[model samples]
Target: MSSSAGTSTQGEPLNATALNRQLKVMQDRINQLEAQLQAGSGAPRAKAGEGTPKERKRVKLSAPREFDGQQAALAGFLIQMQAYLHFYEDQFASEFEKVTYAGTRLVDKALTWFEPILKDYYENGDQATDFTKKVLNSYADFTEALSRVFGEKDEARRAQERLTHLRQTKMHFAATSTTTG
Candidate 1:
């Protein structure tokens, strides 16, 4: 019986060593269980008919658009006026009739596009302001020339003077009228 007990004891380590080995085994088992639980929880989430993970389920914009119609009309008018001025050279006068027609068309379109803005300003009683002032001043010059051409004192002289005034002033009509109709 003593010989059998000794043989069994020889196969086993000391108490401390045995305890350490048991602890390591337990720790390894705990680590494996933790890994399995984590994996189970993180299993591929079922997507509800949505294509792939990379595909967005919904689109959202961060901000609203800001646009001012009056400002836009003012800018367009300036561009058209610049183009008209460039065509006033002597070389361009050879195509005067066509250029005039094009200028008229541009002005018409500008007026049409800007009419609503003008109407709003007039109705609001804020008409005689900024760009409107410049435009009316220019129109006054043009009408002055038109009146001269229809036979004012020294029709030729006055007409030439009006033309010269326009060339000097280089004005455009106001987008809005201060005086309400």
Candidate 2:
């Protein structure tokens, strides 16, 4: 009986330990490549004060400007909307994995219909409040339509409706509170 790791000489099976070790090596290499790709330049990060004066100056000059209340609020709303869209994307991806191709395609089509509104929001910074309101309203409508299509009450759909309602209530309160008090 021969115990060769790579090739089976006498019709023997390959060793599981050797196979797992090889897989581990491949996975390590894949991780390294992914790290390099994410780093953009594939270069190791330099220590502080190690880079050229020009590079250091560039980094120092890239500090973000301070935002006022309205701008900050708008930025927060944009970030929240983006997060919600990403959550929907993850949900659709999970659904695609579990369901048939046709079902996945239907979801893709629905997302396609909503894509333009997301793009518009991304492109325009002016009218941020109005755009956010529109986005929330549209998302609520989409969820309602989705619930109707699925023939079931969806918790996420209901949550979106509640969020929209709460936002409106908050806006109204703020407006009235400013005038009255």
Candidate 3:
């Protein structure tokens, strides 16, 4: 057999024997790693009651004590409503802009009704309990009313009436409570 010379593209003589030795060394290291992995011995083992150096102390977590069930229910209702609105918008993209505008107006009207109750709850500590009750009752009432309105033949008219009733009831309450006190 004739011995052939190996030369790089740059015309420099290449050491084939040295390259083969280096390749063998890398292959051996890879084989050793693979054997260790197969034996489940790649990582250092820690005995019982002698945890690994990188082990962290476990912590227990709990839900917030101040989370109100009623408030959570109300928030869930709002989230459901928002999801329904998004679905509606997707289904009727042609009329979505107008519907969104009307929805914003409705929300603004509702916020106007709610602002006083929130203000009263924040400003007067004594009235907070009463205001909270009012807010929760309003949420429950509105949910029921909305369900009923959606079930009716004239949903738009019924929805408008429901909103009007909510606004008028709160206004009347505010007027009566201020006069009485």
> Which candidate number maximizes TM-score?
3
RMSD of each: 26.8, 23.0, 21.6
Candidate number with the higher lDDT (2 or 3)? 3
Model 3, 1-181: lDDT tens digits are: 1133355555666577755765687799889988987898765555655774346343333211221223324445455554554544444444324233323333333445445545665587565765344443454444443334333457689789998887443534334434554
Compute each candidate's TM-score over C-alphas.
0.17, 0.19, 0.23
lDDT of 3 at 44: 59
CA shift of 67, model 1, Å: 17
Error of 3 at 103 (Å): 14
lDDT of 2 by residue, 74-122 (tens): 3443344445445445444543222222122232434454445445555
Per-residue C-alpha lDDT of model 1 across residues 1-181, encoded as one tens digit per residue: 1123223345643465565666687799888878877888643455676776345353432221211223334434434434544544332433323223332433343345435434544665455555433333353332233233222457589688888887545767769758877
Two-way TM-score contest, 1 vs 3, winner? 3
Give the winner by lDDT: 1 or 2.
2
Clashing pairs in 3: none
Q: Which stretches of candidate 2 lie over 4 Å from their true place?
A: 1-107, 126-132, 137-139, 145-181
